[model samples]
Target: MIIKKTSLVTETKDNMRGGNGAPVITHVIGGEILGNKGRLYSKIVMQPGDSIGYHQHVGEQEIYYFLSGEGMVKDNEETIKIYPGDVMITPDHGYHSIENTGTEELVFMALILNADA
Candidate 1:
């Protein structure tokens, strides 16, 4: 049995350089959950004036949860301001992106579930 309690806090600036100029830390990844048909990941410390590129999933759906700060979520035809504790989801074939619109950093988590499971 795998049983343990631990305190884990990660600083995005410590690792990962985004394609753009933003900093991100991946708290969980594709292989973290085994035997599962989906993936879970988290990106924190998104500074103001930064964003994640828009993209779509071929055979999956994604769920986003904003933990702190404020931001904007853009899709094919809309851009919505997002506040802390907001939960947004993307359909199987929808496209979306996220941007930090606040002065401080934005932290968000994403979960992707593949359809072919």
Candidate 2:
């Protein structure tokens, strides 16, 4: 099966997770597409000053894979810089957030998977 670009869905959410600015999310493969095993499989774009505020995963794990641009991630209350080819993961019971600190836009891929009990 093939999913074309035109068929994909995109949305822009303001103050996402108590963030400073809005970030665009382009859904590549939605949860329903994967039978709910995953919560998110999408491309995330954040303009300068944009961010995804700190949040916790109660029963899941989240991964962020940077494609281009630069940003900072809040991992376990620590701030870490991120760049292209960088991968960060927040396991179950973990907390994290991300902000685009570069002058240009920051693009990355995000994946959220359910944690086994």
Candidate 3:
């Protein structure tokens, strides 16, 4: 299916689980609310000193791609710096979290699956 800009959609606030978020979430596309199958995903835009909470999955693989700005990722084992166009993957047994480490906004995409994850 194709997404059309002229079509009206819904808007919602994202009550972030941690320190100072952008204060909202827009469902550009995904499941449950958008009828996607099995995958629960979203686009999150964060800024310096803002972040998402630390969490993990039991049986899923997750990835965070740095679209812009700079950040760091801790995977329960080590912490590493993230730069533009960088990617970090978290396996099922590892714990991971990302933080903005730049002077500008950090943009990225988060993907999580509901099944066995």
Candidate 4:
């Protein structure tokens, strides 16, 4: 199945997971398409100073692949700088958060998969 870019769903999340400013989220595919394998597959765009607050994953794992701009990620207990082409993986029971610190918008692809699947 081919999912067109125009058919993707986009929305702005305010203080997402307790972050700072609203971040734009574009859903590349929904859970229905993933079937029991994952819950999220999307593109995230965060303006300067925007963030997705630290949170722990219970039964799922999330992967973030940076596409452009700069940012910082609090991966578990480590605070690391993120740049284009950087990838972060938060496994089940791990904690992580991200913040955009660049002048341009931070763009990334996020995928969350069920740990049991």
How would you encode candidate 1's per-residue C-alpha lDDT over 46-76 as one tens digit per residue?
A: 7787777778777877788898889888866
lDDT of 4: 0.96
Writing each residue's lDDT as its tens digit, candidate 4 over 1-117 gives 888888889999999999999999999987999889998999999999999999999999999999999999999999999999999999999999999999999999999999987
Per-residue lDDT for 40 in model 3? 48
Give lDDT per model, in order. 0.71, 0.92, 0.65, 0.96
Clashes of 3: 0
- Top model by TM-score, which number? 4
Off by over 4 Å in 2: none
Positional deviation of 93 in candidate 4, in angstroms? 0.3
Candidate structures ordered by lDDT, highest first: 4, 2, 1, 3
Per-residue alpha-carbon lDDT of candidate 2 for residues 1-117, written as tens digits (9 for 90 to 100) = 989999999999999999989899999986787665877899999999999999999888998999999999999989999999999999999999999999999999998888861
The candidate with the higher lDDT, 1 or 3, is 1
TM-score of 4: 0.97
TM-score of each: 0.75, 0.95, 0.73, 0.97
| TM-score for candidate 2, residues paired by index | 0.95
TM-score of 1: 0.75
| Shift of residue 105 alpha carbon in model 4, Å | 0.7
Q: Going through the candidates in order, what is the number of backbone clashes in each?
A: 0, 0, 0, 0
Error of 2 at 103 (Å): 0.7
User: Cα lDDT of model 3 overall?
Assistant: 0.65
